[model samples]
Target: MEERTDMPSDPTAVDPYGCGCTECLTGEYIPLERATEVHIADMLAGRLRNHTGTTFHLTADYTIEPNTTLPELTPERLTITCPDHELTWTLATPRHRPLEDHHRAGPSLEYSDGSARVVPRHRLPS
Candidate 1:
């Protein structure tokens, strides 16, 4: 599907609604990890702004696969699906913190046909 021209292109410019993360709550966007995830979630949210039937699926694995070419690196990704559009962002820089407990009540979630199930991947139980 074609993109909406009326939508804002810059993700950082967005001040999201009631972000519960420490980074957004405290406004202490630290060097990496937490701060970075906040940005990513906002960015994904921006892309899905006006699209109907949007599904945001997050993953627990932030491992970047081996890559010799800096530009062609395959890192962890955040994917968004809409009724007629899909965007998968390959994050060159993912989490630096330990994968186990860094993020999650639902560390990983799987989605198909709009149904979701939490995948407990070494995450903090909620």
Candidate 2:
């Protein structure tokens, strides 16, 4: 069965982005940078755990420096725990581009099928 709630008079009021509608008194929106970070981290960790459980850690280091980048498709400092080693990996400044962009560029990680997978350096073409 499907249930439906009446649409609010000011639809933006219920929107998390809070488009300045009259009823949007305190709606909050997730900045692009933060959203990108969370999405990447969650998807990456899940895929690592599934494919490389021996090396992936659920509590591995994951952080986003809000002060370093604007909420756009720009590079931001990112550090992620390696899946097959005892060391951490640093993207230095991972751009907030779509997962496809990163995958195509052949970074240390790739995102696809709603998950992020690791791509080894050796896999890259000369």
Candidate 3:
């Protein structure tokens, strides 16, 4: 069963884009630059072990998706672990948000079921 989340509201937000998809938040029209969409759609990461940094093993693969049957105060979508660095992070996908106008021009969600690509083993640490 799909559950509705009790999302926090930002009193200062002014949204003007949305695509009426079952998986996407609805949008309106706007003349503002679309850059803000990335920041808004950013995954909320929660550190579980060591601190976060870009200096992780290049081979450290990560996945992000919700795999729960929610009863959550703060929903966790997925976890990413860097075994080499002994570091971990949990992430939550965006919800109750609006999609940008340009998003409708192409794929609804391109990486919906995609894997991340990184350099091959030849270039990564052993």
Candidate of highest lDDT: 2
TM-score of 1: 0.27
lDDT of 1 by residue, 25-66 (tens): 444332222323334444443422321233445443344556
lDDT tens digits, residue span 1-126, model 2:
764344342122112221344333322322212223333443454422222223433331234566643222333445555454443434333344433444455445554564444443234566
What lDDT is obtained when candidate 2 is compared to the true structure?
0.37
Give per-residue CA lDDT, model 3, range 1-126, as digits (tens).
875454332212222223233222322212112213222222111111111222422222223347632222122133444464454443343342222321333112111233211111122344
At residue 1, what lDDT does model 1 achieve?
Answer: 100
TM-score of each: 0.27, 0.21, 0.19
Q: List the residue pairs that clash in candidate 2.
A: none
Q: How many clashes show up per model?
A: 0, 0, 5
For model 3 the TM-score comes to 0.19
User: In model 3, what are the clashing residue pairs, if there are any?
Assistant: 17-27, 17-28, 18-26, 18-27, 18-28
Candidate 2 lowest-lDDT run of ten: 9-18
The reply for model 2, stretches above 4 Å from the true place, is 1-50, 54-70, 73-75, 82-85, 92-126
User: What C-alpha lDDT does candidate 1 achieve relative to the native structure?
Assistant: 0.36
- Candidate 1 displacement at residue 14 in angstroms: 9.0
